[model samples]
Target: MTTSPLSWLPLPSSTDRAEDEPASESDDQALDPVQLAALHRGRDAGEAAAAWVRSLSGRQENEDHALALEHAAAGIERASHQEVIPGGEGQLAEELRYALGADVLLGATHTGTVPDLAAGERMPLVAVCALAAAMPSCVLGDLPRELTLLAAELDAATAAGRAATTATGLAG
Candidate 1:
């Protein structure tokens, strides 16, 4: 049999996949503080929003649900515009408005009514759909990778805002 061009390289050993191994020195180095903080903010938000969505998964939609969703969406919009960071580095904030807005539209389409969802349940749905819309603009325009990160971060923030609004115990 003819050798494939890829055959010269060795395959990864099982040891490479070991999670118990200690981190390498290079891996120990800290990431940029700003980026780390931004990531935390995004992840916290996403987790919170996801949790809120879960909490309401079995509940019936009501007037309270409608109000809450609208409030959460509005809060996310406000935060997106107001939470500015230095050097315009608030990447999460920059993309949230667009994502949140698309989320509202998408949520409405899927749910048949925006008010049918709990406040915290609506945004993540829309945010996920918005990803396809946002990514192409960045990739096709040859935008910096940072912009894409920011867009993703914004999605996280939207989730957090929703969770914070709907969850009983968390402040997000």
Candidate 2:
């Protein structure tokens, strides 16, 4: 039998699987951070692999990312993950904006521009979406998943801006 790339190497044909003890639920909950960190590192590597595939992309294979945003926001509501609106989509909107602002702040902090808040506002969504849309077809297709995620994140950010405008009666 031919082995697939991801399949285990025949286990040396002699190892008994029944001898291994199953982990208890308590043991599962006690995951060490170091091991979790390795899993996160693997995910980071997978993103790089995705980027490589994206470079060879052609026609659009974009995921319905707007749905992902709505789902994520709904999940937050279900989990009582409120921020400002007590119990609603507005709270999710606020949370999303804060998350986006955090990324900008992180960039400013890294670039030693903490004293200049203007440095943080430079990376706006319009700029990014325009940049992505200008990319080659293969590059866009290869990154369908990442683009979906980015879109969801931006949707959240935009929703937050909407919420702020609503509060000020300017959105009406």
Candidate 3:
């Protein structure tokens, strides 16, 4: 008796959604060249960081983890502020920027409704580095190599970002 407009429509099947919808919501947006390049950089940075972490020899000593994190934050901040790009910052960039500034890895804990392969391996590690590089109280209990891996990952990500910006003609 309470049937409104919702009652008449049939539920969509998986196949219907698979054929009509994009794999992720970000795919629906019309990204310009700059945004596209920046996204590419973000993806690659994640991959590169993951690779670096996977290849690390062992835990880092009590060297200057704070300095490493500070450098990474500075690099990410600079990229976020790049004015040459016109379309504005994309989701990935903003997330990375915030995580870097906060010295935390929000992506590691984020559970999104949509699955994104572009962020499959790299993003998690990228966030890990954001937290690890700082050697905060929570992270102090982690392994030394884990901290090392985080630093290496951040370094790789920053380098990847630089390469991407240069390729996109957005480097200054």
What residue runs in model 1 are displaced by over 4 Å at the alpha carbon? 1-21, 24-30, 60-125, 128-172
Candidate 3 matches the true fold with a TM-score of 0.27
TM-score of each: 0.31, 0.23, 0.27
Rank list by lDDT: 1, 3, 2
Candidate 2 lDDT tens digits, 1-172? 1111111112345232334544333232332444233223222332332232222121112222222223333322221111211111222234444322333223233444321222222243222222222211211232334333433444443344334434544322
Q: Per-residue lDDT for 1-172 in model 3, tens only?
A: 1111111212342122334433543334454454344333333343454333322211222223323334344434333222112222212344444545433222222332221112332354355455332322212333234334434555555465345444555333
Clashing pairs in 1: 45-160, 69-119, 103-126
> Which has the better lDDT: candidate 1, or candidate 2?
1
Q: Write the per-residue lDDT of candidate 1 for residues 27-57, one digit (tens) a residue.
A: 4334455544443343334334444443443
- Between the candidate structures 1 and 3, which one is better when assessed by TM-score? 1
Q: Between 2 and 3, whose lDDT is larger?
A: 3
